[model samples]
Target: MKIIRSRSFTPSRAWGALEIANMNGITTRLHWTDQPYKWHVNDGEEVFAVLDGRVEMRYREDGIERSTVLETGDVFYASVGTEHVAHPLGAARVLVVETQGSV
Candidate 1:
């Protein structure tokens, strides 16, 4: 067993991640980022949970762009084919769960 302190975790670079687990083709990771990610669609479902700081989650719904601010402890679920991007208000830690090798 392992104990992870999400708030204290830091990455060497923006958007860097630490792999936490891989079970039945599903992967869990902890990520640190201060920059915004590019808009893209996940090949499978994705769960993004903010552990620290804030994030502005932007997505496209029915070709209309929308966004929401996610604070610490907020979780965002992205279904397959959902176009989205994440812009952190500052340095933030996030827990992400998705299919292995998915982008």
Candidate 2:
């Protein structure tokens, strides 16, 4: 078992990243920050679990684009080759689980 305090974690201009645990096939973490209008490219499928506050996700679809808001306890997944951007809503926080190994 491992513990990571949110405040103790570092923040990045693009997005804050932290490794809460890396055991077996599960990689868990609590990542939070105030970065808006930035696109994120994931090489593999990843799960973002909202822990607190809110967030807005913008992504492109079949010749169309869309945006959605996710609140506490809400979850979303990003698949490989999917381009998307996200930002926090009033100091948002989330626990992200990367099911597919890093690229």
Candidate 3:
């Protein structure tokens, strides 16, 4: 059993995460980041949830770049082959669920 206070979590680097669980081949992580992540397509689906602060989610759909601001409690779903990136507004904590070893 594990209980984490997302509001008090801090990362040591750009995008650092704490492993929460790994069920089957999927992984659940709590990440604290202050920098933007590179755009990449995941091998499987991904669920990104903003736990604290806000983030700018950018993605490429139909070869066009699109973006949306994700406030606290907002969730973003990215299917396989959907290229996307995340940019935090200041510091933020996010909970991410994705396949193990997915990029």
Candidate 4:
């Protein structure tokens, strides 16, 4: 059980890069900045909490374009194996918590 304050978090320079916090079974990461990117297939569930600013999650699957914009205090839950890319609207910051699943 650890506590992370806002003032203690350092901002990121680029978009794809992530700042990780608790990396036990539950991994916490922070995202700052915006750029075009893609998330490859993975085997873990991801949870995102919008700490400050605005962010957007974009993806296209099955010939469909999907996007979700998150503001301050917003949260999103992504299942395992789901592929998507994240973009910040304006120097946004988001907290991501990843959990591993059994095989």
Candidate 5:
């Protein structure tokens, strides 16, 4: 059993993550970031849950760019081939679950 105190976690660099679990080819991670992640599509799906601070989640739909603010406790679900990026408002902690090795 394990318990992670995400509020006290920080990485030496931006967007670094703490691996929480890996099972059945899926991985769960806790990420700390202040910078924006590059836009990309995942191989399968992803669940991004904000645990602290806020984030502006940008994505493309029907070839048009769109975005939404995800405050703490907000969850964003990205399906397969969903092109998206995450821009944190400040230092934020996010829990992400997705296929292992997916980008």
Candidate 6:
């Protein structure tokens, strides 16, 4: 068993992540970032949870661009083929769950 303090976690570089678990091809991770990620589609479903700070989540829906602000404790769900990206308001900690090796 292990206890993780998400708020205190820090990454060596922007968008760096720490693997937490891998079960049945699904992976869970803790990520730290201060920069925005590039727009891309996940090969599978994803659950993104904000642990600290804030984030502006951008996505394309029906070919229209949209965005929403996610604060600490907010969660975002991205389904397969959903084009999206995350832009941290500053330094933030996030918990992400998705298929192993997915991009």
Per-residue lDDT of candidate 5, residues 1-103 (tens digit): 7899999999999889999899999999999999999999998999999999999999999999999999999999999988999999989999999999999
Candidate 6 off by > 4 Å: none
Clashing pairs in 2: none
Tens-place lDDT digits, model 6, residues 1-103: 7789888889789989999999999999999999999999998999999999999999999999999999999999999899999999989899999999888
Q: What lDDT does each candidate get?
A: 0.95, 0.73, 0.95, 0.66, 0.96, 0.94
Is candidate 2 or 3 superior in lDDT? 3
Q: Write the per-residue lDDT of candidate 2 for residues 8-92, one digit (tens) a residue.
A: 5656643566777876777886777676746766666778877777898788777467889998888889887677777777677
Which pairs, if any, clash in model 6? none
By summed lDDT, which 10 consecutive residues of candidate 3 come out lowest? 6-15
Cα error, residue 1 of model 3, in Å, equals 0.8
RMSD of each: 0.6, 3.0, 0.6, 3.9, 0.5, 0.6
lDDT of 3 by residue, 13-78 (tens): 978899999999999999999999999999999999999999999999999999999999999999
Give the best candidate by lDDT. Answer: 5
Of candidates 6 and 2, the better by TM-score: 6
- TM-score per prediction, in order, is 0.98, 0.75, 0.98, 0.71, 0.98, 0.97
Q: List the residue pairs that clash in candidate 4.
A: none
- True lDDT of residue 36, candidate 5: 97
Q: List the residue pairs that clash in candidate 5.
A: none
Q: Provide the lDDT at 83 for model 2.
A: 76
- Model 5 ranges off by over 4 Å: none
